[model samples]
Target: MKKLLIGTAALAMVAGAAFAESHSVVRLGTEGAYPPYNFINDAGEVDGFERVLGDELCARAEMTCEWVTNDWDSIIPNLVSGNYDAIIAAMSITPEREEVVAFTQNYTPPSPSAFVAMGDVDLSGSVIAAQTGTIQAAHVTGMDGATLLEYPTPDETVAAMRAGEADAVLSDKDYLLPVVEGSSGEIMFIGDDVPLGGGIGMAFRKSDPEMRAKFDAAIQSMKDDGTLNEMIAEYLGEDSPAF
Candidate 1:
């Protein structure tokens, strides 16, 4: 969900208008809806692990990281199209996607994406909603007899599932845990089989290897210095995920 208090229309208004203007200033894109990773804050600013991590790397790279919040589905295409300098969203490293834009080293190791069918509901022939352009969608595509409904954000996907527009929804387990822990959908994982080992990474145009390398080194250092964990705890809460 590239969702913020500012809806998709407002997000697209700024996202579509953004461009990398100065080499010294790197323009980064994020979904701003993936909590613990990126999301809107109470003060109306983008804040979360991914957002803070981007800020950290920008500080390390000695370059200005100007953030442009956008829909997750458009992040890669727009990067390839040269609309931004980098993408700091929680994007996965999938072979299908690598054919388009390039990615930094995995920031967050691959966590299994899961399908939550209502209760002990059977997902054998159900319609599943997933964030479009995600590995979860690709996995849903492979499930036999299941129809895939792609939404731009997980929030929309969940909303659709709640409205009876979709039978189940697919997303990373960590993100879903926080949102669905007490939701009244009888929601539960369909199964843990067919896990896709795809890790989330920062992304950029394939043409920007040098910049990617710079950010990669910066990110790793953050992980080494305990900065990453601190930020993760800050956004996802103290009882945050270990994955």
Candidate 2:
């Protein structure tokens, strides 16, 4: 859901020609690990909410596209390096990320973040696990008494909590709710939901305003026609907020 380090200037240099070529087939980058938003299916293909939404957006914009999976840690850098034309992962629109890449309007509204643990425990001064390079991780790091534990993937964060490496795991409430429910009382959510970032949006190279504009328009069209909200419900559940 975020990034840590990237060479913004290098990304801009590499994006120049790609952004200028309007008719080229766009390559969409994603971390095929975040379920509901995206994940690798048993068939070894990217599949989930973003996959469906992205395909629709591409069709609406009249752009041919393909999916490319990359680790969350290097997703942004790869986009800048011309490895992909855009990032359709469930990336939150944050100021820190905006400095390195441009973002389209949010498709999903800002969802609440929550903490999950095996039992009731005080969050203050406790060790917490969060996916590395995410807003949740940054938020936990700055908490007055919390010691943040970072993991490369969301699954690892949950594993850390189960193994007692952390007192709790913090992440999007939507993402955690199903896991908590499926755990059959082994894991439960504690603490109030916290809102972070500006919702989820697609990321583009800073030089790719044209491509960004194409997608922004396509996204707005979906919202106007109720297609976007429908897709959100299909993947994130009926209660999921729309644009």
Estimate, for each residue in 5-67, the C-alpha lDDT of model 1 and write its tens digit: 211432233223233333678988887888778898998788888877788889998898787
lDDT of each: 0.71, 0.85
Tell me the lDDT of model 1 at 195. 49
- Model 2, residue 9: distance off in Å is 9.8
Runs in model 2 lying further than 4 Å from the true structure: 2-16
RMSD (CA, Å), each prediction: 5.8, 2.1
For model 2, give the RMSD to the true fold.
2.1
TM-score of every candidate: 0.82, 0.94
- Among all candidates shown, the one with the greatest lDDT: 2
Q: Model 1, residue 33: displacement in angstroms?
A: 2.2
